[model samples]
Target chain A: MSDQEILRTTGLTMRFGGVTAVNNVNFSIDHEGELRCLLGPNGAGKSTFFKCLTGQLVPTEGTITFMGEPIAGMDTHEIVNLGIGIKTQVPNLFNGLSAYDNVRLAAKRKHLKRQAIEKTFDMLSNCGIENLKGSEVGLLSHGQRQLIELAMVLAAEPTLVLLDEPAAGMTGEERDRLAFLVKEVTKTASVIVVEHDMAFIKQIAKNVTVFHRGEIFAEDDVKKIMKNKSVQEIYLGKSADAA
Target chain B: MEKSILKDPGLYVMVSIGLLIMIFLPIMMDMFAIMQITQYVVLSVYALSLAYIWGYGGILSFGQSCFFGLGAYTFAVASINMGSTSLPFILAIIIPALFGVLLGYFMFYGRLSDVYLGVVTLVVTLIFWKLINHTAGPQYAIGDARLGGFNGIPSIPILNMPTANGQMMDPIQMFVTFMAILIMVYVGLRLLIASEFGRVSISIRENEVRSSLLGYDVRRHKVVVFSIGCGIAGMSGAMWATYQTFIDPNAFSLEMSAKALVWVMAGGVGTLAGPIIAVVILQWISLKLGQLNIINNFVLLGLILVPLVLILPKGLLPTVKQWSQDLWTIWKKNKANEGDTIIKESETVNAGRRK
Candidate 1:
């Protein structure tokens, strides 16, 4: 176990009803100081995998170790306490509270002191919403809310941050900014981003995992996965003739 | 920069004024009328508790009345059974709080969701109501008095409050006693709403999944928040016991639950101040309405509620907020235009002098 390899899962499996959402999958990462992307098409079980790792859903069969501690059966709150933070695919924000307040709530969980308030503002500034902090998350643009959500997760100071579809509703410029922010986040903690957009994956991810139908289809450098023929076929479909 | 109404001076002023009215209302109004308002306010506390769960925690509890009833019964039984005459009022309060904690532990640890939790609570309330109603027969005796069936524990001892004179309190004194408690409870709730716990509760309401993912003990938080709300409901019940000097199974009925909810709804759900305002207004109206023929009373209620519901879905407070905001904005805009015109004229005058 290295400082970089903060989380690892062995033979993780998740089933819903009769559908095996995540099949037997063994994956580990030697933590690098950069964001990693788990890219897959719809029905590829990326979200399910993220949920399993975050303890939002229990894996039917798996051993998850966070910083060398078994976290498979731990509750979500306990997992978070052990330095894991998750940003949902949908912008899961308190609509009734201002953006600042949403971030403040998360910050208080990390620590509840006046000094923590400054750190929370710093986190919000990092996410590029320090100016619009007081505006309600409901009133914010889709991009701004996403940024606030990012700020919220950052406030927790987790060693491992999982973001699902963070830039789903963001504009191109917003997406680019988010990618940069994600890269910055990786400087302190390993960020595993589950996203569909290739552009974002290419921009931020130093390493990429292409998940295909509940299994790790490919895991390598971003450049290598993009060039891999089978990876492209499975993700983008075979060439026109083959199709 | 994270300024909220809680920090606003105007809010403090408004709260102070409201407190003042509550403090003096009993002196100005008839004893029975003031007692009725106090009961409604107590129910509002229950409503506020529900609002905390529903509006902030995002956990809908249909059986909130369970806690309310539980608190009331706990206080009544404990104080009565112990025969501790000196601190009956205090015992009444403490007992309910204990019940809240006990109930919270069961529901929260059980991992109950909103729908199932609500059903369980409603069933519990009904069961308790039935049991109490049925058990109030021949066997239930306290000292010399017999527990009246369908009729509740009547002749509840007058709440013994300490005053400067060291004399025992009359019924009017009990009104003052409960009124003081109501104010204190309101203030405590206000502070709680502004505390770190309150923030967590609101966050849970906003996004339980996300809040949980961020490391909140969502289930435990729900249970604790629910329990706290119940505890407050219990406090109100204790107050009710003191104010009316009576306790009955009917006090914990479906109608009581509905009225508590109505207070929350008629007041603004999310805002703390809204529940208080709504309770006061609705209680006053309902009292006035009750004076009319029963048939006309309900019809009149519909006439008022229809327009109120239609016009202010956020309740009266939102309407007041909107109206106030509009006025402030117009005033500010006018001030800005005037300043701009003055600046333009001054600039022109400066140019003329240069020429």
Candidate 2:
């Protein structure tokens, strides 16, 4: 696909109980079929920014345009309909529902016919979580739940996916698998990943936006953002070994 | 422990026996008494309605009695005025469904949460009961069929099958008439739940947030399910009017609503069979208690409900399914143990022959 701006936000700001969590941040990402990482230290407003973009919260002052249509006032459901999907840091699968049913719920939104269900079954196979189909999401291991969540978002056939700490609670092998899955999703949809893991970021992110305080400290390729002195101080801290 | 006998076929045979009893029940009893049984069957309609919304749509409408009352009163008044019972009967069911649509619009679009929705329905039911009870008087007559208000509309003509000479039919004919309506309503309900709309209702109950994210108009689904559930309840109400030939504000009181809720909760919220099994079992017990001349009906209700809750919190059907599965596993384990013993005995005999 040709590069284009699928989602754009201007002057995005969020305040909760008089504390400014996210300041006016002007940001846009062009559809480059590549993973873009939003990196920040603790309390850098990374998650807040993602939430605003995904319509989970109405920004105090900002206009979010998705696919060239204003979506700031849209509800979370409407935003999902507008082709933006989100995978939360926590495995937000319905505990009582089987893994297949969880993904089937999302898939039904796209095409709920019998053929569509078969297609969803295929997607599950691709994610290597097909055997867990009959298992309740609550019963699944952490790594397995992540796979189910990915399958669910994919089932919606979203044009853009906002992954908040997709590999937050995973072993090295699990994180690598998640990195591979994120890269694979890029072939079909633009992926925005918010993560602090340097190795995972380097593995998937083609472009990186480094956040500090409540603003973007740097936006560039992985190598430049990783070596930036301010980025090092904010994320890696003063110790050289932190790098 | 033969595996074939432990299979689903045996379970299906049990269900068939239940169905046979249901079909033959009225024939064995006096038709006048059967008409009384029809009242409970009508209540089953309301219970099933509650099941669809509370069990499938995840709405515990404490005001379901409101729709039941609305339908009963509408039919009673219309039948009295028009001097035609059928017209009022049809109107009764339709009006309540429309009422449900309007109520659903406000409750759902207002973004009212579950607990508030229950309160709103409860408040509405109480308000209607109070209004109707206070106003019912002797002068409240529609074409000579008196709307007794608190005394209730009484002696409304039981529907008669008219012949060419305008011959009026008897009570047995009325029972047959209501039975037809009951069967049709029951089948309609089954088909409705099997449709795409039914699936959406179940989905909403499972997860409203997820359903919305999947692009379903959650408010629309809620309204539709609410209307359908209320409509079924209204049909039952119409049936009640036909059988009793009398309806008062008491018919729509909080007590009735509470009983219906108890029935649905004890039966199982999500399962279709829950309400049916609950109705037959609970109503049978209530009937037997009534025979003993018990003034404390509430005590009888508590006796059945408390045990159902304590033993089968997930509802009767889920509990039964779990127990059956456990039994099958135990049987299979015993059979495997016996097979192992026989195999070891055969091997020892072969060793003796070799020696």
Off by over 4 Å in 2: A12-25, A32-34, A39-61, A75-78, A94-97, A104-118, A196-199, A206-243, B1-23, B137-149, B160-170, B177-182, B291-295, B350-355
- Which runs in model 1 stand beyond 4 Å of their true positions? A1-4, A32-35, A96-136, A221-224, A227-230, A238-243, B2-15, B22-48, B51-56, B85-88, B105-117, B140-148, B162-168, B294-299, B335-355
- Local error of candidate 2 at residue A112 (angstroms): 7.7
The TM-scores of chain A alone, one per candidate, are 0.92, 0.93
**Alpha-carbon deviation at B182 in model 1, angstroms:** 1.0
Over the true interface residues, superposed, what is the Cα RMSD of model 2? Answer: 5.7
State the DockQ of every prediction: 0.66, 0.39
lDDT of each: 0.75, 0.78
* Cα lDDT tens digits for candidate 1, B141-257: 655445665788776655554644335476566666655666666677767767768877877776778878777788888777776777777667766665666888876687677
- Candidate 2 residue pairs that clash: B55-B269, B136-B149
After best superposition, candidate 1 residue B11: deviation in angstroms?
A: 5.8
Model 2, residue B248: C-alpha shift (Å): 1.6
